[model samples]
Target: MDSRVANDDVSYSSEAAISRWKFAVSRQYQHLLDKSTPHVLHRWIGCFAVACIYVLRVYTVQGFYIVSYGLGIYILNLLIGFLSPQVDPEIHDGPGLPTRGSDEFRPFVRRLPEFKFWYSITKAFCIAFVMTFFSAFDVPVFWPVLLFYWVVLFTLTMRRQISHMIKYRYVPFSFGKQRYNGKRASAESTSLPVD
Candidate 1:
């Protein structure tokens, strides 16, 4: 004899209504991304604008407090993401680092995808911009000292990241560069016959 019957109250589906809703939302987001991608240059410009505002505010106030520290932390975080390989060699099949010809067939995938990376940077800048409006964020201290420390921190962090890139045989800007095959198919036709 049949034990179960199909009914709304007696349903045993693995995916609930909430799950379907979430899936629909995700698909909509993916569709939006497919239509167009964000320009990184524009995002960087936004970040620069935010930084300029922060700098101008600090210059007028003559001191930086918690906002400066927050900015430093955010910059360090972004740098770490920028320098590190998105695809970890340990997890993925590779010879510790991406090399030419060793795994040419394998597509280079990043651990930290570009969309999220830029999103975080933009978010940080916006937060800093908002913090500028509040008086409590201002700390009574020599603004020059904070600027000096930021410069020093940036230099050291960048130096270490550059060395890591050199050692690992990877370039973060590989995605940005135009890939050239070093061949000209029309070269032979373009040359006039010597005779």
Candidate 2:
């Protein structure tokens, strides 16, 4: 009975140690993510490198076309979400993109935020890269057909998204655009008139 109790205690302590180690590792992972948040350009460059590596792997293997197709589709979905408004005007008539110059100027809010968009794309590529290593994911198909279809689909989707943007008069991007700071009061306007 004493030996049984001792074994149980040892097992419990080992489990507790494992739990603590996992917690510490997760906390460190989260910390790194937080630290990387502000370096948007760097993060994107890293993601681009990963994508390039994945593409190289697929091209060298000459297989996993299906996985590549799936990744492309997933990326298209992410792009749509990134370009879309949070509250779609077609669905709800609430505060949406201003149709006229007289209307209040509200910044465009995306359905999927930039950070989430980047993270999802990066993660998807990583998953597809991993899938490329396995034989089960390497289904054979005519690569040109898939490529052509993807191009057609992408063109149609972009046309629709552009039309939507034009119809709503909202540009999703803000870089190199004019900014209006409220008019500052002139010194003459504030000065008291001397008799």
Candidate 3:
């Protein structure tokens, strides 16, 4: 009975140690993510690098076309979410984006923020890259057909999204609007023009 108690205590202590270790590792990872949050360019560069690596891996294997197709579809969905507003004007019954120039300026909020979009894309590529190693994902299919189909879908989706933007009179991008660099005209300048 004493030996049994000792063994149980040892296992409990080991489990506690492992839990603590995992918590520490999780906290460290979260800290790194927080630090990287402000560095948008760096985050994007890292994601791009991961994407390139995944592409290279897929190209070298010459398989996993299904995984690639699934990844492409997932990315397209993410892109649409990133481009769209949180509450779509046409679908939801609420105050939508400003349609006229005189309306109040409300900044466009994305359904999926840029950081989440980047993270999801990076993670998806990583998973797809891993899937390429396994033969199960390497289902044989004509690559050109998938490519052509993705292109057609992308074109149609983008066309609809652009039309939605036009209808709502809202631009998703921050720099899409024209900036007023010239100085504002004073009341005196307008009076002189009247004379």
Q: Provide TM-scores for the models.
A: 0.61, 0.87, 0.87
Q: Which stretches of candidate 3 lie over 4 Å from their true place?
A: 178-195
lDDT of 2 by residue, 23-53 (tens): 9999999898889899999999999999999
User: Which has the higher lDDT value, candidate number 1 or candidate number 2?
Assistant: 2
On lDDT, the candidate that comes out on top is 2
**Reference-based TM-score, model 3:** 0.87
| Candidate 3 local lDDT, 85-181, one digit each (tens) | 9998989887778777888767889999998998899889889888887898889999999999999999999999999888878788987686643
Q: Supply the global lDDT for candidate 1.
A: 0.69
Ranking by lDDT: 2, 3, 1
Clashes of each: 3, 0, 0
- Choose 1 or 3, whichever is better by TM-score: 3
Task: Count steric clashes of candidate 3.
Answer: 0
Span of ten consecutive residues with least summed lDDT in model 1: 1-10
Worst 10 residues of 3 by lDDT: 180-189
